[model samples]
Target: MSANDTAAANTGSDERADFLQALGQHRHFLRFATRDLTDEQAGQRTTASELCLGGLVKHVTSVERGWAGFMAEGPSAMPDFTAMTEADFAKRVDEFKMLPGETLAGVLDAYEKVAAATDELVASLPDLGAAHPLPKAPWFDGDAKWSARRVLMHIIAETAQHAGHADIIRESLDGAKTMG
Candidate 1:
């Protein structure tokens, strides 16, 4: 309609594009680290840390899904991290290991689905500035709130961090580096 309206629309589109591009790049690096790996190889722990390539992918998918839900549904969408039970902690630990019967392909497919949904949410969210109080957690300030944009950035950071972890695990497993 108006020139101002057009400019605002372009800015939003550009912002979303930038977010998607960063996410895609990190996802590529993470996935590349898993290339040509068998299920057992993907699951093998090559370092002191429990992280494996498939598990890192799975964990990133879960993180993206949870934060995307938080962006859409506020604090209600998040678990009470401050009240997590032993079982909850165990489940979280399982996210870092490829359990039996889990295949690398399956993990990667689920990550693709989660990434697609997050990308769509970034493009369709009405207001990236919309804010919500983070669920009560030891690591978060009690009064702090995060905007959708901030949550997206967190997801990107998480993915990128895990991608590096995956690369290290991969190199340790087979002497193959995702990057120099």
Candidate 2:
């Protein structure tokens, strides 16, 4: 390759690494949100909303897994929410709660595993610009599509938003703050 081509390649490579690092930084914030809290403490619903630190961990894990799966496969790979049974819907709601049989350690461990898988998927993609049709959603415009890089960016936003919520909830629980 010519020097110009090599420079372009290096720029693309650096951009990819920067995206992964940015995502990891937010992931660390989420982890910090749960630090030094017991399972009971993590599960405490200090806020009026049902969000808890441990539950945020679980939800972020599931969110990353779902998006990464879509990026790897396609929109059709996602679940058909309209067809979900009442029981399935209830279980989905419960997924945001650190219910019995769940522990902070277990939830964080699962989040870490999902993060590793997501990073691996991102790094191994041959082309992040590949596009896929979006799933049907009221919030999404008609006939919308997103590239693999867009999906990763969405995951970063989702994770960061929840990390902020987790921080607020953590503060309410024990006056602990993820940020100074």
Candidate 3:
């Protein structure tokens, strides 16, 4: 191809690498917080919040999967948050707990799979600038739209935030700190 085409290709490659690197770093911190924990321990709530180690992993995985789907399929990929019922809210709350029979290993495995898929999607997307209106939610403006890149950034931010939460929970559980 021409020199301009080559430069554009390199730019896309660099952008994808940047996205993946940011995402992977946060994912590492999140997973690192779970080291050597038993399923029971992973499920145990250490702080006043309902969040547990495994539950955080599950929630992050679900968030990444949902955003990635939105990247590919627009607002329809997400449930209407404005229309959620009490049962729907209750089920969402369960995403922050390690339910009975759920293992840390299983939760981590699912997280790994979701992370891999998200990484692949970032690498393969033809255009990160492709935009979609967000699903109806009180937190979102009526006319707000997010590009694929914005969604990826949101995923990274969400992961990093929850990773910090996981670190605190893990430390509370056993004095183990994922970071200083």
Candidate 4:
């Protein structure tokens, strides 16, 4: 290959590696770093907030789906669960209604679905710099817009943060340290 071709290949390689690293680093925390507990164990409200392992999984699923809709479908296409559902508010509730014999398996399935869909959206995006307005919601100060890149990184950050929370909750559950 010519020098220019080699340089382009190197840049492509680096970008691909960086994207994978970002996905893996956050996903590692999202999965094992904040998990491995029974429903009862996960349900324990260690804090005044209802933040728990299961709840974090649910929250992230909702957020990830919301971001996917924003980046892939535009803000007008959907509503953030946080905004649409008002009957239950003023607490970080598990909100996810699981059926009988429902293991963490269900939570994992939902999160994986969202992650896969979101990953595809990120990969196919023509430009990470592409911007879309944030859905109108109560949490913000004013009308806001987010770039496709920001949404992807935000998922990474949000999941990582909650993974930390899950770490604490999991630790509190059985005096266990992280596997990761």
Kindly list the per-residue Cα lDDT of model 2 for residues 82-178, writing each as its tens digit: 5678997788787789999899999999999999998999989889999888876666775899999999899999989998998899889889889
Ranking by TM-score: 3, 1, 2, 4
Ranking by lDDT: 3, 1, 2, 4
- Estimate, for each residue in 97-174, the C-alpha lDDT of model 4 and write its tens digit: 333465566778888888888777767778877888777767744568888777778877887787788777677777
Show pairs that collide, candidate 2. none
Q: What are the runs in model 2 whose C-alpha is more than 4 Å off?
A: 1-10
lDDT of 1 by residue, 1-180 (tens): 899879978777578788889999999999999999999999999999988898998899899999999999998999999999999999999998899999999999999998889888888999999999999899999999999999989989998999999889999999999977
Q: Pick the candidate with the highest lDDT.
A: 3
TM-score of each: 0.93, 0.91, 0.93, 0.78
lDDT tens per residue, model 3, 31-127: 9999999999999999999889999999999999999999999999999999999999999899988998899999999999988888888888889
Model 1 residue 86 CA deviation (Å) reads 0.2
Worst 10 residues of 4 by lDDT: 90-99
Displacement of the residue 20 alpha carbon in candidate 2, Å: 0.8
Task: State, as a TM-score between 0 and 1, how close model 1 is to the true structure.
Answer: 0.93
How many collisions between residues are there in candidate 2?
0
Query: Which ranges of candidate 4 are over 4 A from the true structure?
Result: 1-17, 34-36, 80-85, 88-92, 96-102
Assess candidate 2 and give its TM-score to the true structure.
0.91
Clashing residue pairs in candidate 1, if any?
none
Q: Mind sharing the TM-score for model 4?
A: 0.78
